[model samples]
Target: MSTFGEINEPSSRTAWEDWDDIFVTDDFLNLRLEKDVDIPKEIDTFIILEGRYLYDCVRAHHNLELVNSNAEVNLCLFKTKELNNYVCMIRDYNLILSSEIVELLKKYITISKDVIAIVTKPIVEYQVSELVSKDYVIRSISSSKQSTSNLDIHFPNLEQPNIISGVSAGVLCWREIIDKPAVAIICYMEHPEEQQIQELYELLERFKIIPDIAKFHRDNLFNSNLYI
Candidate 1:
């Protein structure tokens, strides 16, 4: 388990920053069985979904077709706000993750149907220990100190170590707009192959973990003004 840097102020920007395990099916078994083998050499690549992409995906969960005309008012109210605030508010409920995200969304579906209850992972350390038990590593590179005045993109050198059989989606959290982004935990698969890779991503998508992946990207870059 690894730590994402220090947490900051307790604002409405409550980060589900604890780095809980991004839910995966039990099919994502442990890595101890093949810990001794050499990792495979495939081109390491990643799929990038922008913030809007995930926002749209979550919004898609709000199905208006089946609801009766009376419930339409609640749906209308739910549609008026920005996705980020809505998501932040939804996070405050402290709902259980025992089911799939889609299923959870269905259960706790309405924003207010008037006022939605706003609410506000893993240890590769304390954050994710219960979620992930597999072994993995964090790969990073620190560059020369750059000007803090411009909050531009800071790309990673991407000189990552070999991809293993099991690797969970990158988890990202921000205590505030000003802090640096960090990895939550890393997991490995016992054997890496095209099918397994596809399956891993499919499971993540099915469980709706893609938003956390996008959050990692969103938190890592700064605006031209150095704002998060």
Candidate 2:
């Protein structure tokens, strides 16, 4: 299994690369898991797991018992190195969690005493908007057509500042409302933090989901389809 690269179609390859960077980074781990636990499963999967990481692109291993694939959670974070009793972990760090993603995760994740989850996407995504929209991205090394086992997220060929202003565009836009503690998940899917953050703040201000992202990590952020 080959990791996404500068093949004939670099756009797609680049998109995955951006996702790869975000998915495997320490900061991303915090944003997705909303915890301080250092996910020690990967350190350059490209170098450590190599072939196995590439195989992950298929993303066919949907069963939590099979591998680290789950549908129910928005999967801002995960860890799966072992198999056949493989421990596929999930954490919903978004301000307002996604119901679909949660349902999907539950479908495949093999439950045991160790299985765990936390937070809500609807609550999280809605709260962390200091600007109109910020990109929320993810990618896998598997060859499977489906990125995740469910509507985890979609790869859009749109421009930057893409539009994280959808359903989770802050609590005001959300249909069903819940006032859970707003969780801020940092996304480096853009650039020029000051500028990007300004735009995002404006967007959220309108909706009143202005984020309190006083502190965050910024490294390996990417442009939109320009890289894709």
Candidate 3:
């Protein structure tokens, strides 16, 4: 059988470079299976996986549960290489932790009584500020999106005082809630420091959901879309 992309791609003569021909057809659904594992009762003890590698980790480990992502979310993150596997992998996990980062933030806001939200819309910004005014920090950044490679800044110490504000404003806002350096760093970049990444993987080792991320390098990383 042909891979999903091979079957779907139009012939070179007829296809335009700008054409967005992707679709999440019916084949990619209901992939999860029932299983049991000892999940940490304390919310902070469990790890959150995001981006392309999330599917790989989920497919490889029965113990790691699906949290936020679904067919729609997977569709947003999909690239041509992995094709339908990305869509179907969502069904393999037993839990839906939370869908969007903002939802996760709201939970933290309730527990920590501390909030920091990133807003692109002025009207939403005003509403969020008003609702959380007593105990939250609201910072502004431009709504414009830019290519990831355009960013070249780095931070050696995340806990330092008076750091470069608004550098990666979205990431800076998330840093307010995520305590782990690994989580904040991954949130900041598509590709992050190898050592720090290894640190994160090692952290996962404690939970026995270790992903084969150690073998990742520049060439294969792009091809596999593992980092992104």
Candidate 4:
């Protein structure tokens, strides 16, 4: 079992390299499964939710089946009973660690025509007053043919010197290889808040992925022991 630290060891590839050497390991598979777990053969859309905050928000609202998991990540594969859409949620502590799971999933599932990925970045990284004033900023990345007009939020390009890693980057690279269309929604926030979570909930709702937001805030408040 090769650990992520060993797999990510210093490579000769430059910073700009994307998906050059993806290390795949079966060590992360859940031992409960007699054999490998495979994703659904045909998928309407493949959605990847990268952060723990986003994962918690969705899990709070919807019923997701635990397909397989390991110490680093949980693979929740479920279908929306109403929409009949096959969705796979890869929940990870760090987005970067998701790359390994993504590589593993690729073996079992065929890349869907539409891949929606949601990830978060820190506000300090951008330092834009516009972003600071709002709960969060959404930057859309898609193929030229795809329209983001429905989002109704805009921002300047990510600019140079910035690099995208993790499962989001891995998916984009795969999209290019498979000639499929993918949409990546990058949400920038200082921390997870009710408003930020609500915004993401609404976005996923629009995609017919998640159900209505439940009264999770109240539960969190009651469960918290923090004095501040």
Candidate 5:
């Protein structure tokens, strides 16, 4: 597995000096697909959830069928029954993907519209009063390299000093390089709070990407005595 920095060479050092690097070695990621998983030839939206909390929250609410899996990752699909809008979910535990895997993933999905990636950042990292008051704040950065009309309506653009790394960053960088459309939604929160999870659900629902389901299974998982 090759690192992103190695595979995609930057045109100039000064331009990418602030960008974070992805170091992918065999030791860090051992991806092995047990079975051949068929991905849809075309996709309306491809959603990637990085953190464990977000993955569990979405898995709890959506009846996602496992398409592929291994030790580090779980690939699932959520298709709307009526509209037939395909939403592919990649629950990446380690938040790293090789360039070959990234290309292979993009080759099949062939997202016609948008690629949405949701990742989390610690609230302590930022000093914004809005995050302190709201308990969580969702900001976005798009591949367009310019303000997106639709996304700007919902969440503000992610500012400087905050960089995206790992799988989400790799995908976004690839899309930007190819001039395709992709957006990374960064959620800044202290912990896995119900309010924050619900806000995420609402955001996905607004895009008509996820299904409506019963309560999240966070209570059972988070409050369980097994961890204590």
Candidate 6:
């Protein structure tokens, strides 16, 4: 039998507009996220969206530092903000390896404040564990550093880790702004990390950032990060 329809198959070209993987919306954001935060490399930008030129737009705003040139690939939200909401199961999960795309992002995306500074390799979990285990790292990095100033970071439309991390951060920030009256949580469809989000909020609250909503969603209906 033959059916006559456009057959809205997944676009082999791109997927940034994917509706299946819905996170938070701009209105939901309530924050003016109109500004497209950036990464340093086009490959890093499209590393999740599946749009090559998209991240080229990212590089124009910031630089995605290449931590290691040898690993498979990783996306690092170094000193940043935005739902950038990306997800990282391991260290070398999603990274930009396309040299051409890298060049384009370098050429187009540049921002006044570097938000999402990415890396080419996954974050070293062992290193992070060591930092967490270090008394100096935790004590010196404490928010009570009288000279420390607050920074409001912004993530792109992302909603997994990058965006989720920011949202959780914002809520905790709000807590201090309002004196710890609120906090939040974020989650993914396949994986909901409530305890993780709460713990994250708790940690940030110590820094005086009131917390709010702590849940997120992801459908992964896209074909690849290069197009979506």
Best by lDDT: 5
> What's the C-alpha lDDT at position 80 in model 5?
48
Residue-wise C-alpha lDDT for candidate 6, range 1-228, written one tens digit per residue: 677774566658465556658767564211111235654442211122221222222332322332222123322222213322221111322232343223323322221111122221112211332233321111001111121223332222322223322222332333334332212222122112111223323333222222232421112323225563
Candidate 6 lDDT score at position 175: 31
Superior candidate under lDDT, 1 versus 5: 5
Poorly placed runs, candidate 6 (over 4 Å):
1-98, 118-125, 128-150, 153-228
Q: List ranges where model 1 is wrong by over 4 Å.
A: 1-50, 62-157, 160-228
Off-target runs (Cα >4 Å) in candidate 5 are: 1-32, 74-92, 95-101, 109-111, 127-131, 145-153, 193-195, 207-210, 213-228
lDDT by residue for model 2 over 55-146, one digit each (tens)? 23213333222223333343323333332122222332343444333333332231211211111122133332355353433211112122
Residue 220 displacement (Å), model 6 = 9.7
For candidate 4, lDDT tens digit of each residue in 25-105? 775533232236665656666677777667666666554444555444555655665553555565654554555666666
Clashing pairs in 5: none
Expressed as tens digits, the lDDT of each residue in 1-228 for candidate 1 is 565796556667645655545666666321121113322232111111212222233334432112111121112112112121112111111123212222322212222111111000111222322353443222322223222333122332323343211111111211112232222112233322111223223323433333333332222123124654
Task: Residues 129-173, candidate 3: write the lDDT tens digits.
Answer: 224332222222222222233222232332223232221233334
Candidate 1 accuracy as lDDT: 0.24
Against the true structure, whose TM-score is highest? Answer: 5
- Candidate 2: Cα lDDT at 192: 27
lDDT of each: 0.24, 0.27, 0.31, 0.60, 0.62, 0.26
The estimated TM-scores of all candidates read: 0.16, 0.18, 0.30, 0.66, 0.67, 0.22
Residue 211 lDDT, candidate 5, scale 0-100? 62
Ranking by TM-score: 5, 4, 3, 6, 2, 1
* Candidate 2: residue 112 Cα off by (Å): 3.2
The candidate 2 region of ten consecutive residues with least summed lDDT is 44-53
